[model samples]
Every structure is written in C-alpha cells, then in structure tokens.
Target: MVSSERLADIGYKTFSGTMTLYGGYLCSLRVYRYFHHREQLRIAAENQTEDIIKD
Candidate 1:
C-alpha cells in the first residue's frame, strides 16, 4: 500500500504536469492568434496602398 506521503507526492506531480501542459497550450493559441492578426493587417495595408495608387 502506498503511504499517505507518497500519495500526496504523486498527486502534486500530476497536478504540476497538467498545469504545465495547459500553459503550453494557451501560449500556442496566443501565438497563433498574434500571427493571424498580423497577416490580416498586412493584407489590409496592401489593399489600401493599391487603392491609393489607383486614385
């Protein structure tokens, strides 16, 4: 049978590992959103320039 102390230690490690994974997932999502927003801005700027040049 596992000692109470050992059980507590295992629980702590599991919780820490889960949080680490969650943090990484959040960071990846943020990075994806940032790049997506940047690309949209670039496209808009290009379109604006084309409009200005034609006018």
Candidate 2:
C-alpha cells in the first residue's frame, strides 16, 4: 500500500508531465498552421498564374 505522501508526489509528477506534453502539442500545432498557410498561398499563386495565361 502506498503512503499518502507518495500518492501526492506521484500525482504531482503526472500533472507536470501532462503539462509538458500539452505544451509540445501546442508548438507543433502552430508549426502545422504555418506550413498549411504557406501551402495555401502557393496554390493561390499558381491559380493566379493560370488566370493570367488564359487572359
């Protein structure tokens, strides 16, 4: 049987670890948004070029 203090300590560690993982997920989401935005811009530019050629 674990003592009360040990259970509290384990809970704290788990909380901190979960927070760290959440931070990393946020960072990756930002990066993904940036790349997604860039790709969209590239596609728009290509479409514009096609329009110009047609005109």
Candidate 3:
C-alpha cells in the first residue's frame, strides 16, 4: 500500500516560510514609515512653536 501525504505538511515547508518572510519585510517597512512620519511631525511642530515664541 502507498502512503499519502497531507497538504498541511507540504504547506508548512513552502507557503508558511514565504509568508513569514514577506510579513517580516512588510512589518519593518511599516515601522520605518511610522518613525519617519513621527519625526517629520515633531520637526514641524517644533519649528512652528519656535516661530510663535519668537513673535
């Protein structure tokens, strides 16, 4: 008799690995954008506050 393999086992080796790699890449990009946006806002707010203080 021949043995049959399940799809889940095959998927664990292939699809799951790819998904994890892509997810990590996407997460890093999101974090980078979040920090970049926050920094930009901070700089803008500081500049505005400085101008107001000067006046």
Candidate 4:
C-alpha cells in the first residue's frame, strides 16, 4: 500500500515534471543558439587564418 509520504512524493513529482520539461526546452534552445554562434565564430576564424597564411 502507498503511504502518505509516497503520495506526497508522487504529487511533487507530477508538479516538477512540468517544470522540468519547460526548463529542458528552454535549456535546449539556449544550447542550440550557443552552438550556432560558436560555429559561426569557428568559420570566421578559419577564414581569417587562411587569409593570413595566403598573405
């Protein structure tokens, strides 16, 4: 049989589940933007390095 603490824990889990999902989604978006920005910087650096080498 489920005890009172178990029931309360389940309730907390349910509430936190929604928060966790939303937090995860926002975190993923931030990570995606960070990676995209880093990729652009990497490409720009490579181009600059090549230009310097050619000069």
Candidate 5:
C-alpha cells in the first residue's frame, strides 16, 4: 500500500513530466509556424520581384 507521501510524490512527478512534454510541444509548434511564415514571405517577395521585372 502506498503512503500519503508516496502518492504526493507520484503526483508531483506526473505533473512535472506532463508540463515538460507540453512545453516541448509548444516550442516545436512555434518553430514550425515561424518557418512556415518565413517561407510564405519569401514566396511573396519573389512574386513581387517577378512582377516588377515584367513591368
């Protein structure tokens, strides 16, 4: 049988691990979004340059 202290320890570790994983997920998403936006801006710039050259 688990003691109260043991249960509290398990709960704390579980919460900490969950938060760590969630933090990593958020960071990964941020990086993906940043690159996606950068790519879109680059494409827009290329299109604009092409239009200017055509004109």
Candidate 6:
C-alpha cells in the first residue's frame, strides 16, 4: 500500500507544471487514485449491505 506522503510526493512531482500530461508517473497516479476511490466505494457499499441485513 502506498503511504499518503508517497502519494503527495507523486502528485507534487508529477504536477509541478514542468511535465507533460502524458507522463507515465501521472498515469500511474491517476490509476492509483481511481482504484483507491473504488475501494472506498466498495467498503461503503458492503457496510450498507450489512446494515440492511441486520435490519
């Protein structure tokens, strides 16, 4: 798992306004962010499902 500081470092390094939008580092960051978002959504859905089951 990537630490928050490491993600910050990646964001800082990639979006320093000196690099192109198509850089590999930026792409990886986007993908990582996407998956992280998805994971959060999945966890929330599971919690909601559990609550419904309990009720």
TM-scores of the candidates in the order shown: 0.92, 0.79, 0.72, 0.59, 0.96, 0.58
Best by TM-score: 5
Query: Tens digit of lDDT per residue, candidate 6, span 5-53?
Result: 9999999987874566557678999999999999999999999999999
- lDDT for model 6, please: 0.90
Steric clashes per prediction: 0, 0, 0, 0, 0, 0
Instruction: List model 3 lDDT by residue over 23-51, tens digit each.
Output: 99999999999999999999999999999
CA lDDT, every model vs. true structure: 1.00, 1.00, 0.91, 0.99, 1.00, 0.90
- Model 1: per-residue lDDT, tens digit, 1-53? 99999999999999999999999999999999999999999999999999999
| Model 2 regions lying over 4 Å from their true place | 1-4
Residues 1-55 of candidate 2 have per-residue lDDT tens digits of 9999999999999999999999999999999999999999999999999999999
Q: List the candidate 6 regions with Cα displacement exceeding 4 Å.
A: 1-22
Q: Residue 53 of model 2: what lDDT? A: 100
Root-mean-square deviation of each candidate, in angstroms? 0.8, 1.4, 3.2, 4.4, 0.5, 14.8
Q: lDDT score, residue 47, model 2?
A: 100
- For candidate 3, report its TM-score: 0.72
| Candidate 4 per-residue lDDT over residues 1-55, each given as its tens digit | 9999999999999999999999999999999999999999999999999999999
Model 5: per-residue Cα lDDT over 1-55, one tens digit each: 9999999999999999999999999999999999999999999999999999999
